[model samples]
Target: MNIFAKTGGNMTNRRDFLTGSAGLAGILFCGCGLPRAAHAAAAAPHRLPVTVAGKHVKTIDVHSHCLFHEANALMGDEAAKLTPPINGAQQAFMTVEDRARAMDAMAVDMEILSVNPFWYGKERDLAAKIVSINNDKLAALVASKPDRFGAFASLTLQDPALAVTELETAMKKQGLGGAAIGDQVAGSEFSDPKFDPVWAKAEELGAVLFIHPEGVPELNKRWAGNGWLLNTIGNPLATTIALNHLIFQGTLDKFPNLKVLAAHGGGYLASYAPRDDHACFVAPSACDPNIKLKKQPTEYLNQLHFDALVFTPEALRHLVAQVGASQIMLGSDCPYPWELHPVDAIMATDSLSDAQKHAILGGNAAKLFGLKGVG
Candidate 1:
C-alpha cells in the first residue's frame, strides 16, 4: 500500500501524514504515455519501515554525528580550514522536525549522535571549553526529542582527568548515554597508562565508549593517490592500531568490563582478527615478556561491540561470524553516505536469522545503552 493512498497518492511528507495531503492526482499523460501519477509515485520520498518479519523494530544507529556552531566559535582561526560537507552534512545541523524527517527517510527510529574529535589535539583549557559546549548542546538536543535521539558525549581526551570529569558529567548530569572518543589522543596510544583513569571511570560508570577514528595523518605521503585514501584506509587503520595496542598492551585486560563500541565495524581488525591472535607467536620480539595477557588477542573482541557499517552483505555476515551477532549493531555514519541503506544491508543478509537480524537492527544497542520502552 502506498502510505499516502488515502490522500489520492499526493501526500509526500510527514506533514501530510500528520494532517492530510489534500490535492487530487492529475490525469495528464507524458510524451511516453505514462500518467502523471507514475512520476509522483516514483518521486515520492523513500522510507523503509523499521520492521522485520512483520514485527516493528526500533532501529537505533549507534554511530551518527552532529556539529555545533558554538563549538565552531571556540575554534577561532582553526575554523577557517573547515569546508561544507560535500556529502549529506545538513543532517549534522539536526533541527528537530527536519531531523525526524531525515531519520524517517533513513529508516532510523533513533540516532546516537557523536562529535568527531577535531578538538583532540588542542591544549587542555581550550579543549575543555570546546567539549563542554558540544556536550551541553548535545544534551539540549536530546532533551528536546528524547525518544527519537540519544548521544555520546564529546570528551577532551587530550587531558585524561578532564576527560574523566567530562564523561562523568555528561552521563550523570546531562543524561548523555556515553562518551565518543578518537582512536588515539594526539599521537598517544590509548594503552598509555595516562588514560587508565578515564577508562577506569567509564568501566565504573558502565558508560559505553564509542571510538570513532580521525584520519591517519602520518600516512599523508603514501596515501597521496585518489579514492580519498586518507579516510578509506587511514580511518580504519587508525582503529586497527588502537585496538591492537589495547589488546597486545593489556588495556582490554585491565578494563575487562568496559563497554567499548568501535565504529567502521571495529575497523579492519574484526574482519581478520585471528591474525591478531597469531602475531605474538609469529614474532617473539613484539610480545611483552613481563606483561602476559590472560586470553588470546582475538577473544577480547567478545567483550567489545561494533557497528554494522561494513558495506556488503558478505562483509556484514563475516563480521558477525568473527564477532558474533550479539556484538553487532546498526551504524550509519549518517548525514554522510558511508552506508546509506543501513537497514537494507541488515535485511539483505541471508546468513542472519530473523532473531539475529532483530538484535542487530536495534536490540543490541537498546540493551547496551539501557534504552527503555522501544518497539
Candidate 2:
C-alpha cells in the first residue's frame, strides 16, 4: 500500500498536491555549487580547473563521503559493515590533507561530506550520541579547512523526534548545509508518517536532505558473487523505490518545499521518471484507489534535486533532459572512484551550453546551500 492509505486520510486540496508541469520520459541532451572550497585548491601543488567554455566554475561534489573513527567506535562490531569489501576504508578516514588532495585530483573544488549511515539500527540514546559525535567532528573538519569543505549533518533517524532536533542543531549551530540519510530508516521507509516532523522541520529550516542508499540486503542472495551487485544494482534500486514512495505517498505533497538531493544521479528514476505517470492508469488493481498522486508522477521531478554521477556524457545529458539543469550538481562519489572524472563528463556533454554547464558545476548547489562569494 502507498503511504496515503496507511495514513488513512483523504488527499489535500488539489492545489496543494499539484505543482510543476509534466516531463517527457525521454528528451534532448543538455547540461546542467558551493564552498568551503576555494583557497585550499589555490595552495595545492597540482590542481585541476573545472571550467565551462574556458571560464572557471566551482565544482561541488554533493555525493562525496566520509566516516568518523569515534562515531564508528560506538557501533563496535557493527562498524565493520560500513567498510565495503573494497579498499575505501582509508579514504573514509582520510586526513584533511588527503581528502583535499583527492578532491583536487577529481577536479572537484568543494566536497560536501556525509557518512553513509551506520546508526539506523542503534537505540535512541546510542543513535543520538553517534550523531552528535559525527556532527561535532564534521563541524571541526569544516572549520579546519573552511575553504575546502562543507557537510551534511549526520542524523539519528531511528528516532524521528531526535532527528528534528539534531537537524536544527546542525543547521542552526554547527553550520552544516544539509542532512544526509540512507534510503530507509531501520524498518521504515521515509514515506512513513513517523517522519513527518523531521520533514516539517527540514522544510522550515530550508535544509537540504541528501538521500544516499545502503543497498538492499533483503536481496543478498540474488546479488551473491562477483561485481558487488548489491551496490551496483541494489543501491540505485533502493533509491528508486524510496523516491517513488515519497512521490506517491503525498509526503512531497505535504511538504512541498523540502529540498531533497538524491544521490547516485537520483538512481534509476531520473532515467524513467515519466514512465511512472502511466502506472496507476494501467494497473487499477495494483495501485490503491484511495491513494493518488497530486501532480503527474513526472511532475515531481521538478521538486527533486540530483547528482551528476551517472558516469557517461550521454547519461548526464539524459538526466539533465529529464530533471532540468537547475536541479543537478556535480558528484564524484569520491573516496571511491565510481566517477573517476566528474568534471570531464559535463565538459563532454556536447549538447550542454556553457550556462547549463556552469549551473550544473556549482551555481545551483551554491544557491541551494546558501553559499555566497564562492568562485
Candidate 3:
C-alpha cells in the first residue's frame, strides 16, 4: 500500500493526498496522525547517497530547466518564432513522472528548476505577462511536489523596477527560492547601475540569482560553423563577460552578500581567473584606479556559487580548487543531455575527498536554497 493508504486511508495519488482536505502542511509535518508504518513509507528513500561520518548525504541539483507550455503560448507566435526548435523538442516536454525517472537514474533527490530567459527581447507589457505565466506555472509545480522540486522565479529584467516587484511577489507570496536571470539584459550588461535595485532586493531577501547564458549575439557571424561553437564556446564566453563586468564594475563589492550561482561551472571564469588577477599587476595604467577593488578579481569568486556542469572531472576539480568546495554545487543542465553523468563526474574526481564530494553533491545547494533535510 502507498503512504496515504497505509494511514488507514485509500489515496493512491500522492498529489491528491498532498492537496486534499489533509493539506500539504499536515502531510509534510506529520500532523495527519499517520501510523509509524505510514510515516516510514511516506519518507521513502528517494536517493542513494554516499555515506560520510556515518551520515547519508542527499543530492540536490541546482541547475535544471523546465518549460511551461501555457507560458510559451501566451508569448504568442512571435515568441515561438524566436525560440530555437531544440527548446520545444521532445526532451524539453518531459512530464513530472518522466523527470522523476531521470532524477532517479541520476541519483538526484531534488532539482531546482528555472526556465532559460526567452522574452528578453519582447515589449515591456508582453514581457511582464510572460514573467507572470512562467512564475505561476513554476509556483504550481513546486507546490505540487515540494520534496522533488524547487524553483528560481522568472523575471522581466529588461525593466528593473517591475522585475523587483515581481521578485518580491515570487518570493513572498509564491514561496520561490530565487530568480533566474540571463547573462545580459538586452544590450545592457548586468553591471549597469540600472540593475542595482534588483541586485539589492535579491541580497535583502537572501535570494540566489542564477546566471544562465542567453548566448552572445554579437559573435553570430564568427560562431557560424558545423561545430556548434555558438553554444559550446559562445555560451560560456558570454557568461564570462557578464561576470567580469560585475567584478570590474564593483557590483559584487556593492552587493557583497548577494547569493549568485553561475551555470556551466561559472562558465570560463574559474579556469581563467588567475589571468584577471595578474592583469592589474602587469599593467597599472590599464587598470583604472577608480574601479580598483578591495580584493583581486579572482578573490570575488569565493563569494559566489558555481554548478558542477563543466563536463570533465579535471575541470570540476580545477573549479573546486579555485573556489572552495562549499562554493560549488551539483548541476546537470538537464533535458539537454549536458553533463550526462553529473554524479559520476564528481565521483571520478580523485582530488576531492569523500566529505567534499558530499558538499558538492547537495550540502552546499541545500544551504544556499535554504532547503531542509539535506546534509
Tens digit of per-residue lDDT, candidate 1, span 102-180: 6777678899988888887778899888787677656655665678878899998888988898888888776788999
Q: Which residue pairs show collisions in model 3? A: none
lDDT of each: 0.77, 0.76, 0.77
Ordered list by lDDT, greatest first: 3, 1, 2
- Report how far residue 31 has shifted in candidate 2, in Å: 29
Q: Would you list the clashing residue pairs of candidate 2?
A: 32-360, 33-362, 33-366, 36-147, 36-148, 37-147
Candidate 3 C-alpha error for residue 201, in Å? 0.5
- Tally clashing residue pairs in candidate 2: 6
Error of 3 at 187 (Å): 0.8
Off by over 4 Å in 1: 1-49, 82-85, 88-94
lDDT of 3 at 54: 66
